[model samples]
Target: MAEIAFPKDAMRVLKETSRTFYIPITFLQKELKYSVASAYLIFRAIDEIEDHADLDNVVKYEILQQVSELFERPFNNEEYFRILEPVKSIMPDVTIRLEEWLQACPMDVRPIVADAAREMAWGMAKWSKANWNIRTREDLDDYTYYVAGLVGVMLSDLWAHYADEKTDRDLAIGYGRGLQAVNILRNEEEDLGERGVSFVPDGWTRAELFEYAEENLAKADEYMKSLHKKSILLFCRLPLALAHKTLNAMKEGREKMTRAEVEQTVEEIQSE
Candidate 1:
């Protein structure tokens, strides 16, 4: 068996791609397994195609085209293998399983999934020309939904296939939305400091945006409470619980949360 060592290269891609998601993803592995991890890894590549500058355009498109081919007709090769090598090594069954997933994807889903992927690719496609306009929350919202919200949709399907559909999938979907919002919000300070850009531009001040972000988070909490109170997959609860802790920190008037506080909150989540 391949040792379950960290996929350092893949983890680097994950962290640069989705800073907040990296850790919560560790918890999700217990609930969603390595296939979900590989799927998310693919999205992270898609995300990097949009966000990271060190990468070249030709490289990104090449990667995307290969990804398209992989799902369009699953095959393993050096390029895909080198990139996803760690994942493949860790979960030797991942390739066959991923092909099975695509085969099972509805033929009609090509549009919906393709639309989502394209919307995501467009955002990245134009990353070099990222607009500073704040009026594009709709644009960002659409992007987030396409990339992450759809993950919720797929995850719901994944869960339902393995177990009963939670009457709470709607709530899970809300939690996903809230998570996406918080991510956009959390990156504001960095994006501004780094690039003079803001995702929600003018309608809200940073504090107001933080408040707006938390409103979605609060909805996520409501969805968590709505889950069967006695459910045992409590690890799935980590994301919501962390959202609550992060929101609490925001409410406490800190300009930004201290790393120690955030770490404490994560510890509280695992311990609780």
Candidate 2:
């Protein structure tokens, strides 16, 4: 695989915003790494807009709608930047340079990236407009599928394109749900106290949510095992291993892993 020069600025922002993802992204090879990293930054930008706690719900909805609509028009640098300007100050630097991110996207994966971003943006708009009232297991599934499951589908497409691996769409969706459910569980306190959003269903206990996460992750495990490429397998395993470990820690009332523990996990996966 030939190395692509991933944007230094975007890499800075990526490392700045997420230490966890930074590790796995390194495991991806060549253009696949470039494509996945750009997609992640684009998606992260949408997430920043959708989850701006201080922004009015109406503003969030409008911004999300506009972002979703961006893919419909011919790609315009200035126009895209302007559309994102409302939340730019609060967004990460990677997000601020969305047009550059788009430009960096591998030509073949551009449509997949755009489509996933638009779908996620629209879903976020719909849920934001509804004020994130997750009331049932199905509602929770719907929400996770929108924000994260769609990501699974998109990644499967990218993996198929780059790695020539036939990925299972259902298992892909399950992988996303498993990771996202872990996120909701870990961030519940902050989401509820600071954002006034509760992702947990009514009458659901921690154990119930943990079970949901575990079951999805079990499918994620299968999804990983099906892949033969070492780079793709390693790239996918880091996150899944972390999510599984994190879920276990959350069950024990710990929300994060120590740096040493993270290194140990990565080493174990790499050795495997």
Q: Candidate 1 — worst ten consecutive residues by lDDT sum?
A: 95-104
Q: lDDT values of the candidates?
A: 0.52, 0.85
lDDT by residue for model 1 (1-272), tens: 11143244444555555545566656643334333444455555455444544544555555445555544433455455664443344333333233333222333333334344444445444433434344655665555565466666555555554445463655555667677776666676787776566677456666766665676676666755544422224534666666666666656754446778667766866676
List residue ranges in candidate 2 displaced over 4 A. 1-5, 85-90
Q: Locate the minimum summed-lDDT window of 10 residues in model 2.
A: 1-10
Per lDDT, the best of the predicted structures is: 2
Q: What TM-score quantifies how close candidate 2 is to the native fold?
A: 0.94
Model 1 residue runs over 4 Å out of place are 1-31, 55-70, 75-137, 167-170, 226-233, 253-256
What TM-score do all the candidates reach, one by one?
A: 0.63, 0.94
